[model samples]
Target: MIKNSTKVLVLCALALSLFNCSSDDDNDRGNWIERSVFDGVPRSNVVGFVIDELGYMGTGYDGDDYLVDFWQYNIAGDYWVQKADFPGTERSSATGFALDGLGYLGTGYDGVDELTDFWSYNPGSNSWTQKADFLGGVRQAAIGFGISGTGYIGTGYDGDNDRKDFYKYDPTSDTWSELVGFGGEKRRFGTTFTIGDKVYIGTGVSNGLYKTDFWEFDPSTEVFTSKLDLDEEDDYSITRSNAVGFTVDGLGYIVSGYNGGVLNSTWEYDPGTDEWEDITGLEGYSRQDALAFSTGTRAFVLLGRSGSLYLDDNYELFPQEDYDDED
Candidate 1:
């Protein structure tokens, strides 16, 4: 029989062990650390592109009005500064990409109608210049990325129908041209992340159905190859739209989006194995329409909305670190 003091000591040891185990379980995978809050109005569906380590974001709808205000984030310094306002009509859900050291933005909804006008930003002068409009007709919630010095935009809603078509923008010629052979289903709010030479595209909704098919686009060969479906694994819960995708240290991640409701779940994809692993999710409110900035070594997610609540908070991901809520 154990004495009361001995029982007390044993109980304390057991409690400590359990506490350590719980903490370990909580932090075994990825972790999110809160960062500096965004300085601009809290908004969602904002467009952004990275140029020389600086992230340029603009033209999103605050709950009350469409916004054309633009801001720049210095990734290394972890701060934001206002830039010249987007010279075009105020809009949200636009797409933007950086090509040849310049950033390009276009094609979104201006609250009343979908827009096709495109514009370019010159960081050197901190100014905006008009470019040829998007050739793919009016669209919003499309995917945009730059590869091998060229920019591509594809998959979104055009007023009445979801579109699967793609178009390439040649900054050298200041023109847009069609690129076919994307056999994926028509979608809107799809997400993409580039890993080395290939860009992976998936997720979105079409006709009220959440899409699961995934594909890889090789800009070098200009071919789309089917990849593992997002639902291939019995435990995979990666089918989400309006999420943000980014690559860090060669691994791709998709985080925070809406399915039937807002989500904070995060998933990491290994292109080499063609598999995804669940990871620690965003530590903030579950949100959709968030934006991500990947500086190759680090990634940050910021400025999205939950239901009617707009968010201006930001968080940086530590893919292999232990979770610490206190930051």
Candidate 2:
């Protein structure tokens, strides 16, 4: 035979290594555990923000319908409740971010046309108010994030073309300003997240090729630098759109996007080594247009679409990085 014993040894060692690494820093700090996954408005291309321990998800499109309703997820009570509707025209694929306790939402296709209107919500006030427009043209399928009260939005299609332009919004001044280019190829429907002072961008389809290139941008330097590359072979290729990525502390996790159809695979990136690890595929049906954001280390995978139907299923993923107990 081809030495079945040798094969067993190799497989056992590989499994042990994964277990060790997951417990390497485990002093049993018990960081990053999911509390709940709420069933919100079942739709795709939705936008969301995390504010003061509460999470808000809203706005997206279906096959033949668009949406404007909003809902707030209560982490403490493990429940979801309807919130003030988005004041803009009902739409899908809009970008959203939170800054200084205010939730900012803007830009999306409203069935008939893409939009550029911007709006803000204050949970404290239980109301939404209009703000300056996005400055950029109407767009959907872009990513938005905030760093130190400054919001950044860009990288989506504008009508018939894809866009990579980035703009900075200052909520303090209630204004928008252009920033340096993203330094990545122009593509719509990727994923992005802000960690510390830098924002990271990753995989999306453009032209006809699926990309695994990754980059980081510094607000202080106003420049982008290539940092990491994520690649793997699976039933799902990198070819995808409406992907989702979120950050807790400085670690980033990406998952379940669509490539012609829904994708179930997921990946995580660590800036310390500029490396990515393929984690468990999402347990739910493969989907696209699901939006995710994290207040603490825990991340939630909410609703999206699979076959020909919209979904309301929510999944809670725990990135538990418990440090090892030396005792």
Q: Using lDDT as the measure, which candidate wins?
A: 1
RMSD of each: 1.7, 6.7
Q: lDDT tens digits, residues 1-327, model 1?
A: 469889999999999999999876675588888888856569999999888888889899889999999999988888889999999999999999888899999999999898999899999999999999999999999999999978999999999999999999888888889999898999999999999889999999998888999999999989999999999999999998899999999999999999999999999999999999998889989999999988878999999999999999989999988777667
TM-score, cand. 1 vs. native: 0.95
Question: Residue 324, candidate 1: how far off, in angstroms?
Answer: 1.8
List TM-scores for all candidates, in order: 0.95, 0.83
Put down candidate 2 lDDT per residue, 48-88, tens digits, no spaces: 99999888988887667788889998866778889998888
lDDT of predicted model 2: 0.78
Worst 10 residues of 1 by lDDT: 22-31
Clashing pairs in 1: none
On the 0 to 100 scale, the lDDT of residue 273 in model 1 is: 97
Deviation in Å, model 1, residue 201 alpha carbon: 0.6
- What clash pairs does model 2 have? 25-323, 25-324, 26-322, 26-323, 26-324, 27-323, 27-324, 27-325, 28-323
